[model samples]
Target: MPSDTEQRTRAAVPADAVTEPLTDIIDPDNFTPRLLALLSNALVWRESHELRRRFGLGTNDWRIISSLAIRPGASATEVSDFIGLNKAVISKGVVKLVDRGLVLLVDGPRGSRPMYLTPAGAEMHDAMLPISMRGQEIILADLSADDIDRLNALLRRMLEKTRELHVLENGSDVGADD
Candidate 1:
């Protein structure tokens, strides 16, 4: 009961052949979607470390705070949408920020309410921006200016294509299903 990858490996090489590094066999010239994903995750991890050290924040909390800074006075739902976080997680983040005096909930239209960054939250966000920028600069330093621009464009196209494929296969629209 060989797996698909194992079956392919067996078919490709003789039984007596020595195994080579998977990376070597795989053509690096052919751009893999996985390389884009690995790069994205590495950047995220680097950014998360900076946030943890400077702001004592986790990835979830950093996203919440960053979204609020980008668009001040967003409701829980709005923040959730902006940061691509679940409603429950956003609720918890808001509560935690409120307890720490970093955010405040204000009244909204028709009995609805929204959350806004407090003075403390604004100050923390401003302080964090430079640290986050440094992380970005370090991670992207390996790439030349042209490579950075090309990579950004290619990544955007890949993301869009993935979204389209998901929609085509699942017959469901993105975000609307959730």
Candidate 2:
């Protein structure tokens, strides 16, 4: 016979559970992945609106600048992998940046082509850093220093575990390295 707890759970399940709203299936607050992604996207979009107006830049442009700032001489493939964006998107952005004299694609050894930021691109990256940092500060303002440290530690662990799952499922970065 089923245990008391199992019987209670079975009784609580509806015959037509699909008839219920999605919110009933998974409450927005309780859906960790979706909640985190949506909230992060909303905040980024809000923060980037003014940046777009002032810099004539969209998300891709900022991503390119940010990536090159950290890892100069990164190929489009590397940038795509690092930024969690597709190569096609990174390619398009690289084309734009190169045309604008913001990024340079240098021929590397063994027929490899790597990109690095031009002086103008470095300046642009420096300009955007403050805005990005301010947005982060705004989001983190309510958290205590200890809370921020703890959250960062937890997020790092979660990211590492997620990366492991990705490698296991795909044997590589699914969206990276073509």
Candidate 3:
């Protein structure tokens, strides 16, 4: 006999609740991975379009800028690690930012070049902050504060699990080279 907790959990989702055939993989309605991918892709597409239309910036550009805004004087490698982006991509974005006069690369200790936002960069960050916040607000409008907190905690746990699985499968953590 199943325990009460187990019985309740099983009862929460009836066996017949899933309308699609069990063999149908990649069902967005039933597969969490597919749903998550769809959500991420939609969000990225919308954000990229809006940012490019309003500020002539791409999502990666905004990500780099925002990362710098939070961690000023961070090196390209550090920024790449923090943002989970490819080092080459981050380096290219850094060069573009520097050429646009929005970022400054200063020589740091041990030959590492640290990046900082210029005055114009800070101004642009401030201008773009609202759009970013609004996008978050729109997406999370249905979730309560507690729900949002719990959702973030769950996502963090999933990220940690992903790293662990990567290490187990590949003998190295994800983005270890980056």
Q: Lowest summed-lDDT stretch of 10 residues in model 3?
A: 19-28
Off by over 4 Å in 1: 1-31, 170-178
TM-score of each: 0.68, 0.81, 0.82
Lowest summed lDDT across 10 adjacent residues in model 2 is found at 16-25
lDDT of 1 by residue, 65-157 (tens): 788888887888787766656778888888888898988888989876677788998887787777668767976789999999998898789
Candidate 2 residues lying further than 4 Å off, grouped into runs, are: 1-24
RMSD of each: 7.4, 8.9, 11.8
Tell me the spans in candidate 3 whose CA falls farther than 4 Å from its real position. Answer: 1-24
- lDDT by residue (1-178, candidate 3, tens digit) is 9999988887897786874577835656888988888877887788888888998888888889999999999999888888889999998988888998889999899999999999999998998788778778877999999999999999999999998998899998777675
Sorted on lDDT, best first, the list reads 3, 2, 1
lDDT values for all models: 0.77, 0.84, 0.87
CA shift at 172, candidate 2, in angstroms? Answer: 1.7
For model 1, give the 10-residue run with minimal summed lDDT. 169-178
Candidate 1 CA-lDDT value? 0.77
lDDT pick, better of 1 and 3? 3
For residues 108-137, could you state the per-residue lDDT of candidate 2 as single tens digits? Answer: 988878999999999989887787787788
